[model samples]
Target: MSSTPKRVLVVEDETEIRELIALHLRREGYLVDDLGTGDLARTQLSKQPYDMVIVDWMLPGLSGLELTRWIRTELKQLQLPILFVTAKTDPEHVAAGLDAGADDYLAKPFDTLVLMARVNALMRRKSWMDSFNVESEQSPHAHILIGELKLDRDAYEVYLRDEKLDLTKSEFKLLEALMMSQGKVLTRKTLIELIQGDGVNVVGRTVDTHVFGLRKKLKDHSELIETIRGVGYRVKLLNG
Candidate 1:
């Protein structure tokens, strides 16, 4: 049986850029769907599920940020990885892109190698998550409970004091790693490896972004996941 190729949607207004991205992704063995506008991309997204999306910051009909927000809020695809590429290289712009729901940001004149690395990392994470979900479904005990927080791996659900908590895929993965380790302090590198797998060149700050998002969703019980100063993070154990 032939394996299914991963599908990627590239939304870039510049024809040259879009074609370049699509060509590289295709060479990497991914099925590429390229669109010139955010509006068209949104329509395509509604038609079917894509493994990942690469969007430009500026689009003709809708901005990349707007499209990302829609994907997160309207489509409710928190697990879907979105990468933003643009000329905006300021720190604030990068932060805005992440806050707008992009999993990764790349400035214009980006290195093709770096772009491929990020794409591979996101795809690997998604693949791992899909496999984990399948395994959890087959396992009898797929749930973990720490304090009042409960994580059901099989259902891909998290509950705080019986109330469901909304979390992004990255946040969920971070929480899962911490909760699984219990009292063990996971270094940022370790956490990144656990979440994104090894060989993925993800910055340490990326982990912090996911942690911030996770903590925000954790709310009052956010303290359950403690940050070890200059070390990493851990889920507070019952005794320690």
Candidate 2:
């Protein structure tokens, strides 16, 4: 993991800004690809995977924030880290950028040194995650066990009482979302965002479809998924 050079995609409409980022990242031993439009960035992402992405906030088409959200929703498991680089440093802009799915941000007219530092920090975190994932193959139940049920992420299978249950991808995401939240009530909005990110234009009821399907798959164990009426859903811990 230490010796692997990371690939970073720079999506900025500003030519100078794009080049500057590529230059610094190249010096850091990263393979950098600079694209000046969101469409091009999307195409590149689909063709080749990137370890991370640096997107400008104001692209001419499909805006950076939108693009980041797209990546988050469509590439759920890969979950590439995204950094927003832009001149919009106002509180509202920052909040929107983060809410749209940016892992970090850099204001315009930023110092090259600071940009480098942020890049290094992000890359280090990525390296640490890679190291952690190396241990993900221990066992299906060990990875996501909850009482007598097992959420097998690798096999994309769920087992209750040693019987395998059929689950669609959306159902798995919904369950994973609830399990990740422990027993906290996940509001419909939060659950949708957690399962689908900001890209999907899903109404609140869309979550109900997935949850309803998931509840059926869990069968008698369905009691674990508690619907909170006007609130949302929670995975009730056993004995709680």
Off by over 4 Å in 2: 138-240
Best by TM-score: 1
Model 1 TM-score relative to the real fold: 0.71
Cα lDDT for residue 164, model 1? 94
Q: What CA RMSD would you report for each candidate?
A: 6.0, 10.3
List pairs with backbone clashes in candidate 1. none
Per-residue CA lDDT of candidate 2, range 1-240, in tens?
258789999999989889989998998898999999998898888889899899998998889987887786675523466888899989888778876667677888999997886777666655544543564544323457778888765445688988988775557757865775557788887665544422234568999988888888788877889999999999987772
Which one is best on lDDT? 1
